[model samples]
Target: MLLAIDCGNTNTVFSIWDGTRFLATWRTSTEHQRTADQYYVWLSTLMEFLGIKAEITDVIVSSTVPRVVFNLRVLADRYFNTRAMVVGKPDCELPVDVRVDLGTNVGPDRLVNTVAGFDLYGGDLIVVDFGTATTFDVVAADGAYEGGVIAPGVNLSLEALHQAAAALPHVDITKPQRVVGTNTVACMQSGIFWGYVGLVREICARIKAERDRPMRIISTGGLAPLFQQAEDLFDDWREDLTMHGLTVIHRYNTHKDFRQ
Candidate 1:
């Protein structure tokens, strides 16, 4: 079985893949302080409950947090007796050509999303990841990583609002009944929800104008469903796009036939 781990800023996602099918998936809070043994204990307990063995043949990891990546590497080596194939490293082969400025560490999650988006729906694609920071990644028609936009995520924006102002309260990011809100909470919701939708549409339109051919927009990450509710801005929603990309990259690296 292949174990795929996507460690983001706010959450860490795990998925077990038995050859072609996904066996089980789970999400947990991103704790940077957790030790290798602690991670092993937690993962072992979860696997035991799910009736899965601790013997993971292959481990693939894509982490935005550098500290978590180091810890995950330790956990994989110490507990599973396997070395993880970490994305964003020199060894991993990205299917798409990255034309960004040299020395810039493109977030592993973003790169993974790009690879998956391009592989699934060819090039001239835009991947909007609604995570801690909502990022838009644009891929050219020939599968080159052309840069996109980044904006505050819905949750982060709300958090900032609450932190910046004492009177403002943190509200759950749900589309309110009306855009024009009477109450404070409702007003915050309207801004966070519809405002993000407008951001998505505007950025997507700008990216589309740059390309000659029609581009496909794919939305991923935890909060994709929230944005989907407001507008038909995205062509597809891939909840497990990052994990799937890790799996694809893992296969490409491990199997000689997949190497270009």
Candidate 2:
């Protein structure tokens, strides 16, 4: 079995893959200060709940948070007894040709999303990830990571609204029944929900114009389903795109003809 870990800014997702199928998956809050032993205990409990054995053969990690990466590396080595193949490392080989600045460290999650999107939808694709930050990754016609925009995520925006304003209250993200709201909660919802939709459409349109081709828009991350419900911005939705990409990369690294 392969253990795939995606450590993001807000949440960390863990999945156990038994070669061709994902055996189990779980999510936890991103705690950078957590020790390896603590992580091991929590993970073991999760695995027990899911009935997954602790005999994982390989581990793959993609982390956006540097602090969490250090702890995850420690956890994998100490608990799993395996040195994880961390994405964005010099030794790892990604399928896409990254055309960005040489020293720029693109988030592994974004790279994985791009690879999965391009592989599934060919070139000229935009992957919109709505996580800690709303990331727009543009894959060129030749399957190269050309880079894109990054905006404050829905949750982050809500947090900021509460923090910056003295009276505004933090509210859960949901589509407003009407665009024009009559109450405080509805007003906030309308602004956030419709504002995000407009942002998605405009950014996607701009990216498509720059590419000058028919591009497939793919959306993932926690807020994808909610936002997607209100608009037709995304051409497709893959909830576990990053996990699948990690599995793909794991296979590619272990076997030379993995793509075949």
In candidate 1, what are the lDDT values of residues 60-123, reduced to their tens digit?
8998888888888888888778888899888777767888888888888888888888778888
**What is the TM-score of each predicted model, taking all chains together?**
0.96, 0.96
Could you tell me the TM-score of candidate 1?
0.96
Which residue pairs in candidate 1 collide?
none
Top candidate on lDDT is: 2
Write one digit per residue (lDDT tens) for candidate 2, span 2-55: 999998999999998988888888899998999889888988988788777757
